[model samples]
Target: MKLEDASSGSLGPVIEVIQSILNQTGYILPALVLFIIALAIKYPNRLPGTTDPKHRPGVYFPPGADPLIGHTRMIVGFGSEGQFENFKALSDATPAGSWNVSFLGTSSMTFVNRPEYLEYIQKTNFDNFPKGSQFTGRLGDLLGVTGIFVADGHPWKTQRKQASHMFSNREFNTWVRAVIHNELDDISALLDNVTAKNGPGKLILPELMFRYTLSSFAKMAFAANLNCLSPDPDSLKRPVPFAVAFDRAQAIINDRFITPGWYIWEKFNKTGRDMRSSIKTIREFGLDIIHKRLAERQDEKKDPLAPVEGTKKEQLKKEGKDLLDFFMDLTTDPEELLIVVLNFIIAGRDTTAQSLSWLFYELMAHPEHVPKIRKEIAEKFGEPEGGVRLDYESFRELPYTVACLHEAIRLHPAVPKNGKAVMKDDVIIPQGPNPDNLPPVRVFAGERVGWSDWVMARTPAIWGADCEEYNPSRFLETDEAGKLHLRNFGQWKSHYFNAGPRLCLGMNLATYEATAFIAAVLPRFNFEWATAAQGQKSAWPPQYANSVTHPIKDPYLVNVTRVKA
Candidate 1:
């Protein structure tokens, strides 16, 4: 029996109640499972794994933890940003070979960050790792098992193929670049206001970068704009649909580490306690569009850009059959498109924004790099003759700027720590004998095999000892004569885009969004960190597991002073 059936056995009426919920929601399996798990958790004597491990060794936990909460106190008390420090400390403290990460109960969930081992897990024996219940189950209600983020085997394969063909086209890039240019004056205005106040400055809030990227994503993906001009005003315009919901979903996912806690009890209420309004907003927005679009498929034959049978002029004119349009074209299931778009929006906005924000922070932290970046920007098209945005080809040509951006991604991957589960009991990563009293350390069918966020990026094996350094030079090649080469610095050891078949589909889209936003912002002004911001540090773990990695903890309050030179 699945956890949903097994856990919710006594809530006999729950089957129908949950089915009704499943009907109302987009992610059927996950919603049903959430409710079922919620119902089941009320009685935990029946919980699994109470019995001691077959091999009784002293303790599977790490060294310095308090016997009671173990890492929970640090994780929960600290929040997401704090956990980054904790991980850094633990990583630095632990020597490579075999190390243990302490969880709630006994066995310390082992974390190995060496390169050769990292390669095995992420590639050589890739399928052995997949999204386990620890991560996916909690998000199931929100994501469902339908999309690429959750789908296994063929479903995932199809999701990849479809996205590659439709969303990755140059046409989408054209649309995105045009949207960014269309909004160029608006973004420049913000930079101008800031620069006048503080000489040269940048907005440290990843939210700004997020909005820029999201606006671009909105234009391309949904053909709508979040209207993210002024923060508070734009926020009120549509309420943040994607941000908080994703955060809450991720927080709940992270709560699993504490165990015997909130996850299973979240469903019995009118709405799952874990459900954030933003998740609903995002779903509603996407589904409403899907329904209206599907309801008028007849017009698709008439005019690709003309009004539908009954919609208004502006609506009628938006007849472009993008993937989202294709999604409407393909599935009647409510959760399907919403879930797909949910992941897509999350993928596009958060990651790109975070990357850009941190890149700026790095630039501000090292004012020297700004000249190099500015020179790269200037060399391409000379100076942007007054208040103008650099076009697409111009944006792509700036190699050093792209290098800085990739370097930021390497240091601070937005989607840090992706979880994957093994479909079978296999040696996914290289297997060495457990010291003793360990659970054989095999990559099982349903477990969070590893946290890939920083491991691969910082692997010495991948980028040498400089893996931990914030050098953009790694991404920019220098010829034997010391001349700078602009070769594509595409893949790094870090799975920031999550290597293998399950790589992020929005990679190119995000690149375009970041480049466009940067081209618009870089030359306009300089930046400085807020007193409390610049690399503030993670306050996580105690906060949530499934959170996006970004620079809020270290966000700078920049002055976007207009350039006089």
Candidate 2:
């Protein structure tokens, strides 16, 4: 009875307290309830940066954008290489060259597609544009601080001159070319394996292509060979850590657009940990080499710097021979040197491999095109010596093949989106064609512009109604006298090798590697669909933004067959 009475007393006090509170706040209660109700009424459920662009006051979404995530959903469903069609549709939905895209953390950013506009930003206003901090800062692992990819100001100039002088000069080309060509070993081995084992039936997708390129980069860039492809070899060598670090870094940069907090949040994620560790290894590796060389400085056997005696003597006596050798010729900023060279290897390795894979796919799908390309090769160089190579001039002259490769790059470039910052408050690009029938654009400081490569490559305004088609014929132009000039191959005389002072330094090398690899493989081997056992799940049914324009994600398990002689 005492317990029951105590419980009753507690209930009574609680009821009394509530009544007293309600009585004291009689006027405020209704207002509070009304405020809560009004908020729910005014704004329904809203995700960050996910809203109707037309109705939003500050950010603008393009016309017909889905209120939630805008074009994000549509783009996500399309694979990197496969996204061209959707990009075309979205492109056509707006102005030819200029439109606002919902990006950079759920906000709408401008998308520029016209050739003239690209040419201007590339050439005239090159000084004002640079890769943004957001893109570079994510590389906290692979690059210690600054790299040729991220640095601006006079620093970039110093690095550029050093890099270009070493890489572009004749001396570096001689040794570097031979080193890169040696990677063809893997390419040949892969083709021979495919041809001998598979016959005309099974398809083997090219995942080895990734490992091959990575190993090749080791040889060309560092004068070391990290063979990821040897039988019974552990593919995850030091290069894996380095490559992982770079991939995760770029991936985190890409994620900023979706979650916005990915870079920070990923601190606790698996890739983030891997990336951090990889950076430590890279630094240690670099330091070890530096110290070893210093130790060897006093030795008489073989000193790379033996020719240079004093501090200024060595400074005055550098030449380009390898990628690192080129970096050695440049500035003495050790941090920048390590960072930029690592970034360069990342760029050179994977992108070229991707292009080659796509080229193979295109060749197989368009089998007839293969014979034509082979005919061109036979005519130009003739009879296949196992080591028969096409020099730079010969590689450039294969118009149809070059056009086909251009089409592939156009539709499926490695870097799908370009991120650049508008330097200074006064920089603005006005819209309209530059007497060449192109669109107009304007840019401002702090504003980041990401022009979609797919949009520019396949936009109808740029490439006509059949812009999305993978037809090499589109790239061909026959003169009145029936002679084909190089102009017939690219819609823009430059097909996304990019334009301006910031053009890719590795363009010539990349093209040579890609063309040679393809020329060597296509005529000799045949690839079909991969086996069920070989197929792995693809994250690419809907590709993330981190990839090159595309990836062969469905675990391509194609058996290979040697072509009849």
Per-residue lDDT tens digits for candidate 2, residues 185-283, read: 555664554455434533334556676677666555545444455432233223455455555555544554445556766689875676567567767
Write down the TM-score for model 1. 0.74
Per-residue lDDT of model 1, residues 384-503, tens digit only: 654436665664577787778878787778876544555665543343432322222443333234554565566564467987778887667778997776565333344577665666
* Candidate 2 local Cα displacement, residue 17, angstroms: 12
With candidate 1 superimposed using the best TM-score fit, by how many Å does residue 239's alpha carbon deviate from the native? 4.7
Q: What are the candidates' C-alpha RMSDs? A: 11.5, 7.2
Error of 2 at 564 (Å): 3.6
Best by TM-score: 2
lDDT of 2 at 121: 64
